[model samples]
Target: MTIRIFRPLRVRDFRLLWSGMTISALGDGIYTVALAWQVYDLSNTPTALSVVGVAWFLPQVASVLLAGVIADRVDRRLLMIFADVLRAIAIGVLGVLSVAGELRLWHVWVLVALYGIGNSFFYPAYTALVPQVVSKELLVEAAALRQFVRPLTMRVAGPALGGAIVAGLGAGAAFLIDAASFGASIAALLLMTARPVIRAEGKTMGSVLGDMRDGVRYVLSQRWLSMTLLAVTFAMIFFLGPVFVLMPFVVKNHLQGGAGGLGLVFAAGGVGALVSSLVMAQRGLPRRPLVVVYVAWALAAFALVGYAEADDLWEAVLVSALSVGALVAGQIVWEALLQRCVPSEYLGRVASVDSFVSSGLVPLSLAITGPIAGALGALVTLRWAGVIAGAILLGFLVVLSAATALQPRPDPGRA
Candidate 1:
């Protein structure tokens, strides 16, 4: 059982892709630590930190639908490589400016916006590309392995290393490392040789807007996919803002901790996610993947309520771990289901819509959370966010349970 989890590594192309993505994830973890700390340091306000979130997500919301169309119509590998190159340039500039002591909050906002643009293109392509690189039998394993390694590196080791470097040196070093990591990912993409999935005969590629509309129509037509996306969108709107915007304040003001403490809290979440990923990798998908997905997410939301009321660093660490573990477990199953069920021609577009819907409201959430927290108090804001998210998930679970269309259909060919 244990050895089977690592079976995906035997595929040479997947091995290279996985290794490169792992390095990139690690760098991203470090980059996140640096970016958040830098923002708070510059303005000493939660609103400023919220601005960072807004800058990153607003661009993504604007372009992600189009990005999905491009992903479906072009070589996903090339799209990913181009996105990486753009991110490398953005991060590299940020690094140079930081080291020269010419960095400003506006500068961070601009660079982060650029990074978000890169992300808009990178994610859909990457999601759609994964299934192409590995055999169908390895789909679940590949997805599990990715979920396991990404959080382990990006969330666990990456944030910890970034925090240390920031404390001992500065944010500049972390930015440089992130830039280099993008270069590594680009190189890996260049080496990969995978043929693009052919479009169905007699199917004409539409304009980007037309393609996006078709994608939206397709998701709405599927009861399970639409409902699942709705649940995720609402959950993220209520959950992500509080965690990203208030966690730093909670660490500094409530716990009286510094960068290292913040990193540890984030790392704790990674630990939990890694553990969950390991379990999923070994066990494979649950017998009832859809039911498990909703239930796990609901549990995760309830666990997040613990974060709102936590009084000490240890309490925060424990709750963060629990929340992330539950979240990641469901996410792994969700990815696998999408890869298994969605048609190859429409996979990129579906993945894009998934990203788009899930993240569409995030910018608004991030933009308002700071003011809401300032008015209502951070603890009150975070607590209510969790409660709302939990309620939404519970509702989703009940509704989905009654939908016969969402029930699992057996695949005799599946391993």
Candidate 2:
């Protein structure tokens, strides 16, 4: 299990991608801390912080279908390389502004929106690109290994390292670090021996809205994929969205803590995720991935509901740690299932649908969270979100159980 962390490095292509992703993820960690702190410092309001989240996520929802179409119609490696370069430029702009003493809230919003656009492109391509690199038999192992590395970078090393940089150097330095990582990622991508070839060419001047509709229709046509998307989409909106948006408020209001306190909690969550990743990397996933996924979400629901009732910082942190573990483990399973169940030809389009639905509702959640928190109070809203999410998830579990039980098995002789 310990050695599983290094197992993916054995494959040449996967190793390159992993290394690049790790470097970029490190920058992501630093940027995340700096961004959050910067937003809070500038506005001193939770709504302001929430707006920054909206800026970041709005682009994701907007660009998802376009990103998907491009991923399918162009060389994936080129798409990734372009995305890395564009994002690098955006981060560099932020770094330059900060260094020049001209940084502003609007500047942050613009840059983050640009970065979000790149992210929409990067995610679908990256997800689709994985199955092309690894053999089918090793997909679960590869996905688990990838999931394991993310927390190691962003959650654990990212925030802590970013905090240290901010404390010692400045937020400008952190932004510069993010830029450099993007450069490194682009270089690694350029070095790939065999880049994927995309061959869908009808017309370049077609309507983006129509393309989006086509993507959505394609996803809904499949039972398993539709169900998966529905689950993840709602999950993102209710569970993940609030958790991220409210973390700062939780630290400031409830824990009476500072940036360091938030960093510590995130680091703890990282540790929990890393531990779970290690287990999955070594043993691989359970045979019935659907069951494993549902169970993981069930655990997350419990963790959040428990967190809503925490009496102290330590109790909150404990629940957060558990929730983080479940979240990452479930993601690992979901990624593998996408690779296994969705056809390669439709991977990009399907991934776009996955991104659109799962991420589209997030900005809406962020937008509404502020108002809801302000009206109902942050603590009350937090508690309500947890309870509602848990109840919904339990209902999903029951329905899934019934569906699986009623599904007829194929005859052995037919095989």
Candidate 3:
């Protein structure tokens, strides 16, 4: 029987959740592009943008552990709504200031930091909410659908729209758009009538440390899980900052790209991710987790290399799409693995553990990437980062696959 990617949408609550989140993601996409350019416009230095990234990421890293504990303990729906409300206010204030010609680099940094804290809470709660809304039978399709949201709306359409807005109306308008998008998300959560299955009942704030330790111990006990997480963290450390921080410089300086051009490059990445998600929806995730996840992800290095070498805007677009598509394929598989293998009770915390490790080094990476790219130039730095990232990813896979008891095995039925 063929698996339909939209099967999870048949579930009412999941459908509402997905729809709302999709809109919110579109807003995020707009925010990403607007943020990059707005900061670039303010200081015109890579270090300036990198510092903003640091300010934004540090709060997330600090808040996520506590966010996880809170997510599992509270009504996830309420937690998510509260997070949405907080972010909307922060970004809304930013939008108003930007529109008034009174915005400063410091304002950008502070508001995005606020935005990041809200993001830390929303993520784990949202991850745990998925399994509750859908039956186990539909998890694969649901996972694929979840993967679908970002590439299509956020990466593809959002960037394109943001570029147009930033070019025509200014970054402030884009920020306001993002703030309003949260309303859609809030409405979706409120409209959800289903209780959904939740394992966090009776959990309280008093057990914060105990709950955290349990989550950590569980991840540590699974060699495959822990090792793979480390591999991803190390790989991101090598490449993540370069990808986010240097792209605008590359586009503006080398490719002679305007804001619209930059958005198109981002959209290309989304297109690539969208295509990967479609393939996963049609043919379920691979039986060989090690081969699919690592190998496919490793290929992103080649695309990044191509991006570095691209002499023109279109060439850059092509490579960006290829790299991001490769990334999402690996990510989709990993997310499903976590949902299937981990218990519902630990879902929120484990998801946070994954986020914490993956994101822990991001601020550092962003912090250093600017100075290094300044010294070496954006394209040159990208070439080195790609090679280093690929080596770490593939090296871990080969080493871990050799361990008899440490390899991650996919579910025989769906994954």
Candidate 3 structure quality by residue, lDDT tens digits, 23-55:
999999899999998899889999998799888
Tell me the alpha-carbon RMSD of every candidate.
3.3, 4.3, 3.9
Where does candidate 2 have its weakest 10-residue lDDT segment?
A: 406-415
Error of 1 at 263 (Å): 4.8
Query: What TM-score would each prediction reach against the true structure?
Result: 0.87, 0.85, 0.84
Q: How far is 140's C-alpha from truth in model 2 (Å)?
A: 2.0
Better of 2 and 3 by lDDT: 3
lDDT tens per residue, model 1, 36-62: 888887889988987788898789788
TM-score of 3: 0.84
Ranking by lDDT: 1, 3, 2
Order the candidate numbers by TM-score, best to worst: 1, 2, 3
Worst 10 residues of 3 by lDDT: 406-415
What lDDT does the true structure give each of the candidates? 0.84, 0.76, 0.83
Runs with alpha carbons beyond 4 Å of true place in candidate 1: 36-50, 98-107, 163-173, 245-264, 308-316, 367-384, 408-415
| Residues forming the 10-long window of minimal summed lDDT in candidate 1 | 406-415
